[model samples]
Every structure is written in structure tokens, then in C-alpha cells.
Target chain A: MIAEKLVQTYKVSFDQNNQELALAGSMRPQRAAEMADCVKLLETSLASIRGTFYVNVKRLVRLNNVAFHSLAGALLKAAEERPDIKITIITSSVIGWSTKKFGTLTAKNPKIVVEEYDSEFYPGQAFLEEGGFVPVLRTQTKLTWKHERAILPRHGLEPGMTMADICCGIGDFAVLVAKEFSPSRIVALDHSKSSLAYARQVASEFDIGGIEYIYGDAAEMLLEDGQFDFVSCRHALQIFNKPEMIVNELVRICKPGGRVYVTNEKISQCLGEPRGPSIEWTYEQLSKLFADFDMDLEFGPKSYQALQRAGLEDLRIESFMVTNRDGDAQAFADMIMAWEEMFAGGMSEKRGDDAAFVEKFRRGFEDHIAAALHPGGYAGWPVWVASGRKPR
Target chain B: MDLGAGQTEAGEFTLLLEFDMDMAGFTSNWSYCDRLSTYFARMISHNRSDSLLYSNLFSSALNELLETVYRLHAPTGSFVCSVSRNGAKDRIALTIPVDTETEGFYRDAVVVLNGGDVSPRYHNALFSDGPLQPNIGLLELAVDYAACFSIEPADGNAIRLIAELTLEASAP
Candidate 1:
């Protein structure tokens, strides 16, 4: 049954691509018709299979508006023909530029939700509204590829590994791990309800299984003792007003001999100076809380410090540089937009002018990217990923 | 051209200026430099046998000594006046200026007598032809000097020697 479904899915995708090619002026009518017929046969055979087919038709709209429409028509036809097989399509709303007939499908599949996500192509709400469909798809594709490449390392993940992603922001890493590592289970936990909701939608649309989306304070949620083999908290550790408590919680969830991985941008390095309350001050305050626990804390270079005082043992520190690059002008613009939002949102609670701060941040990002793109721009933002084990 | 060829005995002469006055009240009214100056002028005026040049030298030395004393002790509203006699042959003078701002007990005044080429004994006693004796009469002289002379107050000011005289005199 899985094979049959796979064949049907492959045929549908081929037909969609062929239709897109013909409309893009790259395929003749005869070739397009032949691919269409193949799609029909597979659709007929796989009509009984239960699953959802997700396609980002908006991506095609940029290469050829005609092809995008054609593919959209084919997807709608397939969905209508196979009532048993649920189909959903997602696209950035910026692509709303196409024929009005596209939006007409919103009524056909109430299960088919159209969400306008913050895409790598167009990061901010404004660009996501103005840049149209192609940039959005390009951004999403770039981001997806980035996350995939970053999390795919065998050393970072493995099968049957149980991991917890705190502040999993749209589950980019969560989905990557789920798709690539085939982990036994992952709890993609976040404090934002909306973020988690979108993450769930994306997971379902991509048919990513084994990921449990949970919304709440990850630190507050109690886990069954020694349940997880590995626990990870990334990017979100800096947001916690009380990061030590969160760290303690991460340690608590992992079984003896289980690894706890935590990663965050050392803001001090990124900003070139300490901007807020000192990390050392916070660490010292938190270390007292974990004095009773037997663990070694090791701090990696570039502001990655292990909490040695916390009794965390066998600490290992590693460093990585995260660069956001898009190949073209629109892609770059979209990236700037997204980062502006992130900066504005992240820094809004602190003192100072939020707009100015975001502008400065955007400029810094561009400067960094320009340097990195050149032969000698080795200066990239550093991310510290450190891990420690709970003594058996 | 007789230079005391005939034996004519000159009677021993002592000049004493006496006044009935309150010591504390006079010191309170006068500055240390003023007292020193008065004593210097009186010593120069009374010693007629000394040359005008030697008298000036004595006054200048007294003034310098007063400045030095003011620098060291800086007594409040007090002064020192001294005179030296080289066995009735040579005269030396000294003075000390004090600051009214300093608070302390004013001790007894000292007088050092030294002879130049006139008296070998005077030189031997002072060890350097400078005065080495303390005299109670100089203390009286200091009080009389304070009573008779006008000196700008040393009040936190730099001490200075206002006069000097360089004179060579043979034994008289």
C-alpha cells in the first residue's frame, strides 16, 4: 500500500512539474499531455490510499505564472477525484498576485489551510506581502536546505534518539531531525502558541511523523524521569529570563548517560561587547541552584561557558558560524526583512529605541554577509553548542 | 696722633632700655617679624663702636635668622630677638620671626655670641665664630622689639631677608 501511494505521489509530482515546464515555455504540448496522462493513471491507482499531498504551487508561479496555474489546476483536480486522499497546499500570501481563480480553491478543501509564514525569501511581514510568490518559495527552499544541512550530521543526531527542542521556532530543526535522522520521538516545545500551531501545520503538511508539538514553558513541563536519551535547547536559551532553571530542567529530562546539548549565540561576541547584564553574573547566580547536582559545566570559546561550578562533568564545547545568505537581490532583501522582525521582537523588551536598534542590527547583518561572501569575510556570528552528560 | 697712648681708663658702660609693660599683651599685639625687626634696629643703633657697615651686617644677619626661625618654628604671635657680644670687642645680632597662626608654648629665647678676628676665645666657644649662647636679656630685647618696631605679619607668607650688610672690620 505504501508503494502504491508512493507511485501515485511520484506521478502527481511529475505531472505537476511537466505542466509547469510547458507553461514556463520549456515543454511542448505533446510532452505536457503525456505527463498529464501518466499522472491520471497513478491518481486512479492511488485513489484508495489515505494521506495528504502538499505542494507549494506558489513556487512555480514565479518561474511561470501559467505553469503555476496549470499545476494548481491539476492538484485541485486530483484532490476532487480522490476524496479519500486529503491534499493541502501552502504558500506565502505574498504570492496573492496570480489569477483570482487560485484563491477560489480556498473553499474546496476546508482542510487545505493557506498560511503566510515568515519565509527566508521574504523575512518581514511587509516583504512577505509585497515580493510576490517566487521570492517566498526561494526563501523557504533556502531555509529548508540550510536547516537540513545543519541538522543532518550523524554526529548531531541518530536513529532512536529522543530529543527535546525548546523554543523550537516553527520547528525548522525539529522537522529536519524528524525527516533526516528518523529519531524515535521528538518533543518540539515552544512557549509561543502561534508558533507551535504553525509548526504543527507545517509538520502535517510535510507528512513529518514522530514529532510531538507541545506548547508551554518547556522548563515548567515535567518529564518522566530518565525518559529521554538526548535533550537539546537551541536559539531559545538566551530568551529565557532565567536560563539556569531551563538548563536544570534539560538536565532533569535526560537519563543517566544521556547527552544534553544546548546552543545559543553568545550575544557578547555578536555585539562586540557586553550589552546587557553580564552572562557571568547570571551564570554565577544560577550555579548556586545546581550546586547539589553532580555535573560539570564547560564553556566553549566565544562566550560558550560550561557551568563548572554547577558540578556538570565531562563537558564538551564546540563552535559553529551561522550565516544567512540568499543568492540574489530579492532574496537578500527578504532576509533583511526577516532579521529585522527577529531583532525588533527580540529586543523590544529591553531599553532603547527599538526601531533604531533593528536598523543597526540589519546593517550589521548585511555587513557580515558581505564579508562572508567575499574571500576574506571569515568573521561570522558564532554559535556555541555545548553538551554534558549526566553521570550514570 | 695719639691713639690712647696715655693710660686713660674708660668706665664699663652698659645700655639698658627698660619699660613697664605686659609681655603677653605686647606679643599678642605685635607680629614675630615686627619684634625681630625692632630688636635688630636697636642692636644696630646702640652698638656705636661698630662701623655703620658692620651694624648693617648685624641687622641683615638678624633679619635672615628671623626668617629662618619663622620657617622652622612658626610660633603663634611670638618672636625671638638676640644679641651677641665678643667680650666687649665685637658685636653680633640675630632675630627670629614666628607665625601667629601656629599654636604652641613660646620657649625661652637663645642668644649666641661669636667673635670675628677680634676674639679667638669667642670663635672657640661657638666652634665656628658664630654665637652659641642663650641669654634671658635677649628675651627682654625680643619683647622690647615687639613693642617698638613695625613688621608686616608673617601670616602664611613666605619668609624673606629684607636687608643685608657685608662689612670687614678689624678688632677695635
Candidate 2:
């Protein structure tokens, strides 16, 4: 069965002050076909907005032939509905596929225009995973003894060594490695420029040196081979689009005999699992849901095997548990909410009805929190800490 | 409607607040940013029902603008934020200037916002420029929370952002 349109797949807004109506997201056929509905919804929300309506297709990675027609037709309807409105479609140079249609779509209506923009990274993969984590949350996790042991000496990190922290969200691990091991050189690389800047700020507070920050994709880093003595990425493997490729890339950049550490959650180990209502969902569930629907999730647990496949020796996996006491029910709720918010978009494919599914998950998660708050109750989950050595 | 900072008139359809600061003041102090967001959130929650849409929009718009400012903050640039209402519409405007070196980065962001390209691809590409951070504020300010918004370039090296909320039924 064809899935329903993904909720929040695209967002439309009309800024009256600026006289602009903006649309952003991948214009899939389902969403594009509902253009009139979108127009109706916006009009219902705020009828006063009328002027330049811009649809930025730079991030709209793929538009089916039908989607192009649907979107163009919708905008024409919008323009006709309100003769005062001009429709503009902004596209990226990388999206050569949709530009020609946009040009033809708007050629007849002077009210519509196509603008092309050049961006270093548009319509690209997520560079900053987990939405650039909170510094406090990151530091709290890092300050743990077990985390330190897994990442530090156990991973063979030491002074005078060169290292790379791949997908280094906010570079907290890089800052820690730089501070504790005093590496000769450390490269903090992530797709998020803001996280890197924060990482730089954190690193600056310490007397660290030889730390360079690079903003680029993990799958395709511009670093030289054998450049670092060790490489590490934490809490980001499962969410990566291509875990094996990233693992191979990590292996490629590490000096022979250097160590590589990758950490991620085994969905089955997350707190509130096995106890919450059957409605409780994990990110892994979303992936499976999409798979069942014949769609690609491109996210899941892939650390240990990928490392071994990269030919790293002495591969090992250590599991650590994070638990919350009855007193920490609120904290538990926050955690569940964060996870739901992050992965909800993926669940859209499997949603029977957007609101009901969302409400079910939300209410069920809340009930689980209430259960956790019961006398002597506790919630915990396991984290897979894995490492291997690059062959010389 | 006298839409000035800190102006509150009883029985009026709207209230207005304005703020102006430099990059150093806005980014150098986290408390300041937090206070600004909290104020916007509190004002709407206090003055109206807990369901006021503009309240959340203001919070999201301010946070988004602040994140961008941190990424492209100039040593001596300015930051301007305004929250006003014209009849049934509540509006917010944020403007910040970037350092010359980072102007290209800020410009690209403006392009994405103006184009209404908020896909992960566009955002990831825009943010890939390590220097980008997560816009949790903007994420929280999803389209469900606001009527409309836009991003564009302003005078000099600054970027101007605006978010609007229409309160026809909810107007007092």
C-alpha cells in the first residue's frame, strides 16, 4: 500500500510583515499532490498573508515528475486565488534535475520566478548528529569513570599521539582527548559548524594545542592517510547513513597500529523498553517500520561488525548501563521525549493516522514514566562501547 | 498601536517589545540569551492564555537567530530583535551582522531560509559550513508553531529574519 504523506515532511508559512509565503522540504508526490490542501490550511491559519510565495527546493533533494507538476499546479492555483501573490522557487545548483521544470513552470506567470543559489552544503547528509548535543549533557556523560576508561587508556590513547574525532558533535570528546592525553595533534571534525564552534570554545578554555577543527562529511573527509595516531566517534554510529563507509574512513585515516573506538546504543537496551506500553517506540522500531514498508531507514546498530570488517584486530565490545532512580522520573521523561522528537519524522511512514500514532506514543511514554516513578522503580539501558586496532 | 519595547497597553490588540545588542553582548553571555528567550516565552504565557501561538514562535525565532549569530558573530556587529503586533498579527524580527570572513556562511543560510528549503539536506549542507551547530531552537519552533517566517539578507553584512503569527480568533 502506498504510505500516506509524511507529517512535517514539509512546512509552509506566510510572513505578512515580509509579504512572503515560504515552503521548505522534499516535495514528495504525496505532499506535492496535496498542494491545494496546503494552500487551504495556510489560508485557514492566517488569511492576511499575500505576496511573494517562495519554495526553496535547495533541500528538496528529489521531486518526482508528478511532484513537479503538482507543486507547479498548486502554486498556479495559489497565484490565481490571490492575484497579488508572486511565486518564487529557489533551487540549488546541485539540484539540476528540478531547475529546468521550475523554469518552465514559472515562465508563463511573471508572478513566479526561479532563483538558483550556490551553497557549500545544501541537500546533503546530516553533519551534526543528534541536533548538536547540549554541552552539559555531553560533559555529564563524558565525566563518568566508565566512559573515561572505555575511551582513554583502554582505547590506547596516550600523550604525543595524533588523533581524529570523527562526527565529533560539539567536539567534546576531542576536547577531552586533547586535555587528558595531550595528543600532539587532534582534528575535531563534524558536519555541524555550530557544534564545532562550541567545541572550539570549550577547547580554548583549556591550555590545549594542535587541535584543528574541520567542517565536512564523515564519509568523505579531506584528511591524509595515516594522519592520526587514533580515531574515535561516540554515540553517532547508529544514526549515520553509512556506518560501514564511515568506519572504513576512520580506519583509512588512522596510522597503522593506532586504535579506533566507536560507541552507540543497542536499541534493545534502551530504558523504558520491556516495561512501557506496547506503544512505546525506539529509533530501531522506526527503521524496522520503514523496512516493513519497503523503504530504507539507513540507520541502525552497525559498530562492531563494521570495525571488524575494516580489518581491525582484537575487536572488543563492552556494554555500559545508564539508569535512573525513581527520583529521576522527570529526567526519564525528558530522555524519552527527546528520543521521540528526534525520530518522529521517521515514523511518519508507518503512521496509520498522524495524530493518533503520535498521541499514542506520547501518552504511552508518559505512562511508562509514571510507572518508573513507582516505589523502588528504576530505568536503565546498555551502551555498546567497541574498539579495535588498525593493522600495521 | 504604539509598538515599542516594553509597551503594554490594556485593551489593545497587541503588545510590543524591542531589543538591540552587539554580537559580543549577545554571544559572550549565555544568561542574556536565556533571559531573552524566557522573557518572550513568559510574556505571552502571562499576558494571554497558555495556548498563544506567537509566544512559542517568538521563542523559536529568537533562538534560531541567536544560533546563527553565534556561528557568524562579528566582533563588533549588532543584534536587533523586535516583537510587535499589528492588529490580529503578531510579528518578530531579528537582524544580526556577521564578520566579513563568515559573511558567505551567513549568506548561504539566508538563502536557504528565503528559499524555504528546510530539509535535512539543505540544513546539513548549510550547517556543514564544522562551524555550524544544531538549531534546537529552530527545531522546537517547527512550522506547527507559527503561521509563517522568512530569512533574507539585510543592510551591509547582516541577515534579517521574521516570523509571523495571526490571531484572528484568539484576539482579545
TM-scores for chain A over all candidates: 0.49, 0.58
| DockQ winner | 2
Which run of 10 residues does model 2 chain B get worst, by summed lDDT? B45-54
lDDT of 2 at A63: 38
TM-score: which candidate is best?
2
Q: For each candidate, what's the DockQ?
A: 0.00, 0.02
Q: Candidate 2: misplaced stretches above 4 Å?
A: A1-151, A204-210, A273-301, A325-333, A344-353, A371-375, B1-172
TM-score of each: 0.36, 0.44
Q: How high is the DockQ of candidate 1? A: 0.00
Please, what is the whole-model Cα lDDT of each candidate in the order they appear? 0.41, 0.56
Tell me the lDDT of model 1 at A30: 13
Please give the lDDT score at residue A392 for candidate 1.
87
Encode model 1's per-residue lDDT on B2-60: one tens digit a residue: 01112222223222221212223334432333343334433333333222223333333
